[model samples]
Structures are given as C-alpha cells and as structure tokens.
Target: MPIHNADIAAIFEEIADLLEIQDANPFRVRAYRNAARTIGEYGREVAGLLANGEKLPKLPGIGADLAAKIEEIATTGRCRFLEQLRSQLPPTITQLLHIPGLGPKRVKMLYDSLQVQTLDQLARAAQAGRIRELPGFGEKTERAILEAIRAHASQERRYSIALATQYAEALIAHLRRAPGVKQAVVAGSYRRAKETVGDLDILVTARQGRPVMEHLMTYDEIADVLSHGDTRSSVVLRSGIQVDVRVLPPESYGAALHYFTGSKPHNIAIRKLGQERGLKINEYGVFRGDERIAGETEESVFAAVGLPWIPPELREDRGEIEAARAGRLPKLVELKDLRGDLHVHSKASDGRHGLRELAEEARRRGFQYLAITDHSPRLAVTHGLDAKRLSRQMDEIDRLNEELEDIRLLKGIEVDILEDGSLDLPDDVLGRLDLVVAAVHSHFNLPREQQTTRILRAMDHPHFTLLAHPSGREIGGRPPMDVDMERIIRHARERGCYLELNAQPERLDLTDLYCQMAKAEGVLVAIDSDAHTLLDFDHLRFGIGQARRGWLTAKDVLNTRTINTLLPLLKRTM
Candidate 1:
C-alpha cells in the first residue's frame, strides 16, 4: 500500500500525544508535533520521493532521527515507537484529548487520581459529582466537560476539506488514467467547498463502465469495497473516507453532475421550477413528457428552468436561485484576486522560515506584498518578541525593503488582546508598525459579554489594524468562543478595521455567515493565510472557497488590492 503525507503525519501526531500523556520531556513531544505539521503540509509525497530513490528534502523540524523514522514508516508502514507507547498505557485514553478543555496534563491527572480512562468513565464520574471534587476541576468545568462529551458523541465523523482533497485528488487522477475515461470530477459537498465533508461523490463519463470499475477496484488505498457493478461502485479508503463513483454516458453527464453536486434544498427548488415549466429534471435527464430536451450541459439544464448557471459554492438554496433568476449573482472572488497575505509569521516567533526565504516564496506566488506579523511578547511559548526586539525587527524590515525587488515586506505584530481589553504591546510601540494584528490568544472561556467587550475595546485602540482569527475556533478541536459576532462585525465597520478569514485548514475562522454579515455592513474581509511556513500559502485556495460561499466579490476582500491601494487603507485603520 502507498503511504501519503497525511498517513505519516498521523503516525507522528499519535506519537506526540502518547508521549505528552506520559509526562515525557516537553521538547521531545514538541519535536514530533512540529515534524507532523511540516510533513502534513508539505507539497510533495514523502513516500513517493523515497520510492524513487530520491532523498527527502530538508524540512525545518525534521532532523536526522526523525528522517530515519519517516523512512521506517514509509517502508514498513508502521512506527515501532508508537506501538511501544500504546502498550505502556490504555490506548483509548488518547481519545479523551478530543474533548475541548481536556489537555494531555488534565487527562494524565484524571487517570492518576480517579483511574478514569474512557469517555464513559469520565461521564460517570461527572454525573456522580465526583469530577467537581477533583483539585483543578470545579462545577463549571465539570458541566462543560459533560456537554462536550455529549456533543462529541452525537457528532458524525467528518474530514476537513484539506485532508479530503488529498484523498480525492489522488483517486480522481488514478481513475482518469484508465483507458476510455473522458471526464472525472468530485462533486457533492466537497465540490460545494464546505469546511468539512462527509463523503465524496465522483462522476465520470467513460466509453465503457467495466474498465473504469476495474481500475477503481485496483486502487492501492482501498480498505474495503462495499458494492460493485457495471456502472457504479462504493468503497471506503484506508483513511475512512467513503467514495462513490458512477460512470455515465456523455449525453446525461451534466444533469447527473448537477443532481449529485447538490444541497437537497437547492435541487428541490430547481425541480420546482422545472415542474412549473412542464418539465422533469433529475439525474438522468431533463424531460418534457418523456422526451429528453436539455441534459448535455449544466448551463442547458439551468436554461431549461430559466436561470443562469450558479457557482457551486452558492448552490445552497440560500437565495441563490432567486438571485440567479434576477441575474444578480455575484462574480465571486477568485484565488487570483489576492494581492498579498496580511497575517503571517517568521522564525522570530513560532514560524519556520526567515524573512528573505518567506519573501522569495511570496514573490514566486505573484504577491505584491506579504506582512510578517510575528507574535508579541505575551505568547512566550512562541518566543514572541518584546518591544525592543520588535523595534529591531522593524529596522531589519526597513533594510530588506531597500534591497528586495518586486515584493515588499510589511512590519507588523500579532499582538495579544489582553484580558483587560488592552493590547499586549504598549501603544507607543504599536504606533511605529505598518499594521497591528490584534488577536485573542488566551481567555477563550470568558463570558459572552466580556469577550465581546474585550475585542471591541481592542479594536478601539488607535493603532489597531486588523483582527486575526476572530473566533479562535479549531475545526474539530476547540469550540468557538462565546461572543456576539454581529456586534463585532458592526464595530469593525465603525472602527475601520477588518476581520480575518484565516485560511489555515483547522482555523477557517470568520466563517461564511460572518463573512456575509461583514459584507452587509460594508466591512472588508481579509482572506489571509496565517502561514507559519512557505507551503502554508496553498491554503489561500480554501479561504477563497469560503469567501465565495459567503457571496464575497473581489471588492469585498481587503488583500485583493495592490500595495499602492492597500497601504492607504491600512493607514486609515491605524
């Protein structure tokens, strides 16, 4: 079986989790975690490189020992160290880490004190009121744990769009290689660019069905095949992502794509329009009293119902059909529109690359500018910069600007929004920078009113420029902090600051709804890749997908403007 980057990353992540739970050396645990991130986001397949007798390229956190381990996993498909760690503890205890507030330390404490090793065990302890009696956990924390447990139990397993893309793209490319295959595309929610996808729906037009199905069954990563037939097959990948592939004739391909690439409500609305027009629309074809009329292309299907083609991101039955009818559909923002990334980091903080390397990559991406917003002093874990260090960094930026060509680097800091609603860096220091990206690094559990007020107060600072990762939610890891988002969006409009649509896979913050809300209030949304490494810029495509879903056009985004136009806007906010 072939090993992909995600597979290797998962192994390293598990090693880190188990080591942390055992109270192992913090730096050792951190090394594995960092290696996992670097490999996971790497643009090429490490396994493939090794297979071709090519050396693994030098990465930031992967040293000699880690490189050997990567070779071990790539060649043998298992990590012996991880297996040994699993033997030393109840393997299931790692699942406890999935709960929002439960870190490895808390899990270790719970196990040592009460012998709690599973969700059911933890739930029983909480229900019996024993968890509150523990030293660190009180009634409020106990209640939140119980609630998180319930939510975790009820939730369906889903993959982040980034991870799903890896599996989907590889499979589609494989299918396209089969003889007689014409078109292959992944439809459904993945096509709609949802943050999470449950499964994949692939539609292919082929000269013959049997050869395509045979090629699919031979896919190296297949864990199990659920069904197989002449025209359709269903299989689950080793990563636990289910995929259904259907082979169709060229004539009915478009109608089938439209039907399968759907939000159920949107399909119903289109069908209703077909009904009123005395036509029948479905996966097979568009028919008028049993005679097929329009099924050759998606545009023809839409024309049959008297509407223009709708972008897949907007086909959620969210007033898109009506807008298409009125010819008011937006020219949704594309990836090419972005001029630069606003919230980025460097080795001075937690980031991987140096200033010149980051600039070279940004220039290669055709960006006019890239802001280097390293962390402020409050996040000492990241080796965040103090005022004196920040000034020195600013001076460095001035020198780089004089020597660099095409790409200009902006000086900035991701200053923490402190608990008392103050910026972490003093106002005098903040005033000297080109931009100040205010963020909430800690205190994620404050009351709704306090949280909102804290952010609002931070935005009011004279030097505040943009709000980074507004909600501070990690897709499956942490619940979004409780705050009044509407009030925040309106306040950004009033204060002339912008909200970030963070493009990191886990933290696609300022969700589609919030983006729409900001647009309604005449506030620009900066679709930024809060990139810690060079490869992280690829995440901008995910942000663009999210922006289109929110009905954002090029004009609604902050970073779409060139440096000449954007610097003026940043000055107004400052």
Candidate 2:
C-alpha cells in the first residue's frame, strides 16, 4: 500500500517521541513532530507521489532537516532513537492516546501517579484509590475517567436502524407540532432511509419568524445546546443523540431542503457546476450575482443547475449527478413493484404468525406470493425445523396454497452455513423446499479469506436459491463479517443464486453501491423485507430507496415477479 499523509505523519511523530527518550539531537526531534502535524492536516493523501518516486521533502512539512530523518528511518527497520525509547516504556502505554481526554501529558501523569498502562490497568488503578490520590485527580475526575473507559470499550460500531428511526420519529413529530411550523421533515442520510444512520437531521419551515428558534430549545429532552441562532439550531438529546434543526422561509424551502439533504460529494459536484456557470449555491438560495435565481425547493435546485431531480438516497455525489445529467439514472424500483416477500417467517420457526395467517396477510398487501422461510435445525433457539418439520411445513404450504385466493405461498428455509462450508440442512431435506436462503449465524469473526470461501461454497450448493444478508451486519451493533461482497455477488450470479437486499432497516445488505454493481453484472436481486412482525413490513420503503440508489428497477428484482413466475426458479431443475 502506498503511504498516505496520515501513515507517514504517524511514523514521523513516533520518531519524534523516540528521539526525546533516546536523547538524540534536539532539532531533529522537533523537526519530526512539526512535520507530522503539518502533513496530517494537509487534507489529502501523499501515497500518489510515492509511486512516482517523488522525494518526501517536496511534500508539505518535509523540510531538508526532516527529509534526512525520514530517509534514515525508511532504510532501516529499527529507528535508532525509537529503539532506545522502546526499552524504557511498555509499548502498550501508547494506546492511552486513543482516549479523548487522556492525551500524552495525562498519560504521563497516570504513569507517574499509578504506573497504569492498558485501559484495564488504568481503570483498576483509578477504582482502587491510587489514581484519585494524585494531585489533579478526585472523585469527579475518577468517575469521569471510569465513564470514558467504559464508553470507549463499548463504543458502538454502528447504531441499530430501529433506534435511529425512533429518534427521527420523535423529533419530526415534535417539530411538526411546534407553533408556526408549516412543514417539517427528517432529511439527510435519515431521509434516504439508509440502513445505518449516523445522525438525525430535521428541516422545517416557520411562519412566526425568528422567535421559532426559542421554542425549539424549550423541549426538556434537548440539552448540551451546541449552537442556537435564527436560521439554525442544534442540541444534543439526553439519549446521546444530536438533533440539528434548520428553519427555512417558505419561499426558499426547496432550496434549503436540497442544501441540507446533502451527500457532500454530490453537493460539491453541484456547487462546482454552479461556479462554472456563473451561479452560486448555498442554503439561502442558488444565486446569480446575489439575485436569487432558483432554489424555492429541492427540485428547482437541480433544474436551475440544468439537471433532473435526483432522489435523496442518490444524492451521495457518487455518480448520481452524472447519471442524472446523462438522463441514464436507473429506473429505480418502488415499494409497489414488490410482488411478494421471499424471506418471511411463520409459526414454523420463530415467526409470530402462523403459515395461513402469514399468507393471508401477504395477500392483503396485494402480494402475488409469499415465501414462508423458517430457520433450519441448527438454529435451535428459533425452533429450527428438522427433516420432519421441513416436510410438514412444505405440506402445509401446499395445503394453504390450495385454499388461497390470487396469492400462493412458497415453502423455504433459511439454513445455517456450517464451518465446513456445508448447509445445515442436508441435500435430501433441502431438495424438498421451494427455496433456500443460506446464512451465517455463527463464527462471525472468521478471517476474510476463509469466510469468503465458506459462504461461496454454500452458495455453490444447488439448493441455495439466495444468500440472505450476506454481510450479516446489524446496524450499529456489529460490523459486517469480513466477506468480499463483490466476490460473493459475482459467485452467486455465476451459480444462478440470487442475492437478497434484505429490507430490514438494520440489515439493508448489498448496500446501494453493491446494488448498482450487481445489476450491471446481471445478477438478480431479491428485495426480501425479512419481516418478523407486521409493522416491520413497512421497511419496504427503505429497501426500495436503497435499491433505487443502486439503480435497480422492477425488472432487476426477482421478488417483484408474480408468484406463478417465481415458482420455477425455486426448483433445483431450473
């Protein structure tokens, strides 16, 4: 890998610390630290120049003095000064730098005060009364330290979709009821209905003028007021959630909406185009020499800039504007396009409803078909089906299909992928079901190389019609298991196995980029809601927008087909 600015700057800083402890030349020590900071804040990667054999000194922060030190370090595995420092302190002490309040100065204090190294040791020393005895430490200080450590350890990798949705719902509802509020919406990444949301953004129009800003701060849940002004205000909620509310004039509502609902890259690209056309873009309005030209609404912002209206999800500035400019945007699929739900549960496994009840509900939603996919036997907690139960579920599906109206029920199983690259359900058992969704429920932390091979092997199994939520990620709780999405999607396409765009907000797997790429590669995707409860069925809207972000259309999705047309694909012979 080429050395990025951060990568080089970090190494340089290490050199500086080592020099201090090594008792090396003073100027040499200062040069490394100074250069490291300068390069780090440069805002771009320097890896590109390394490939071209450009000397380091040519880059910012690399003066002749610093350049010599870099050359010496790169040529030898051991930096002479660093080696000396390594002998004096336990290397693990460096990790204390990761804690927000505990910088190197505080780290040195903790070391001298209690000789603590790792987080566990530090937490213990603080708790055992050694830390609070120090000159600057006290009960409140120790408590803060303890909380920081706990927070760091439990730093959520992602937020659950449900949690984000709840916050958005409350904020939107509250703002809508606020006096003078004409229209309010949860915009930004949340508005796009993303699987994992980072923040909650609220946009509103106010008729009562500047006083509306004061009313917003009155809510009891709002605290840690960040910034409050006429046009904008922000506060951190008690739940550790940040809510940003922007008040817009009704006339500039659309323009303000477009600016706030940003995919930064998309915004950058649009602004670049505006600059080229002698126009300016901002939240106030898109302007020509201070005379407001367009931006009454989001639609006009795009029209003013000579482009078609782009959806919020596609605003990521990731080829979306180009696609819009070319009029080649994918005819995105919608919730109405979904003809059936391919991965659903019933009383056969852990589902709340029974087989007949599930089918009837699907029919009620105007679905032409519904697949009752229960967990296989390995998932014991879910009442996973055995050979006998699988046979019964299939027979029940047949019986129910005979009694149903326009809709038909498909029998399927979500079989576990075993460590040995085999499905939990045997070939004989799998052969009986109309469809099979193979998933990985255990051994999530397997190395990427092994996990990819493992899932690909299961997909190669003739019975696996679809790979369910291939990443196995739950919003904010866990990172996706290390599997190559591009590799897995390609393997499934080659084997004629569909990849599921699981509609569950927490697991909108095969994200927008993967969705578009998969379509380009001729892979058939199933927009399965993976609905467990009746209300969870509403997640279809998020999935549809996600699919459209990937540029999917009704024709590109497998589940959008009528039940009659879907049956043949479920069989092994097809």
Q: Top TM-score: which candidate number? A: 1
lDDT of 2 by residue, 246-267 (tens): 8888878887788778877888
The lDDT per prediction is 0.94, 0.76
Predicted candidate 1 versus true structure: per-residue lDDT over 329-370, tens digit per residue: 999999999999999999999899999999999999999999
Q: Model 1, poorest ten-residue lDDT window?
A: 85-94
lDDT of 1 at 267: 98
Candidate 1: stretches off by over 4 Å: none
lDDT score of model 1?
0.94
TM-score of every candidate: 0.98, 0.72
RMSD (Å) of each candidate, 1 decimal: 1.1, 20.2
lDDT of candidate 2?
0.76
In candidate 2, stretches whose alpha carbon ends up further than 4 angstroms from where it belongs are 1-158, 218-220, 572-574
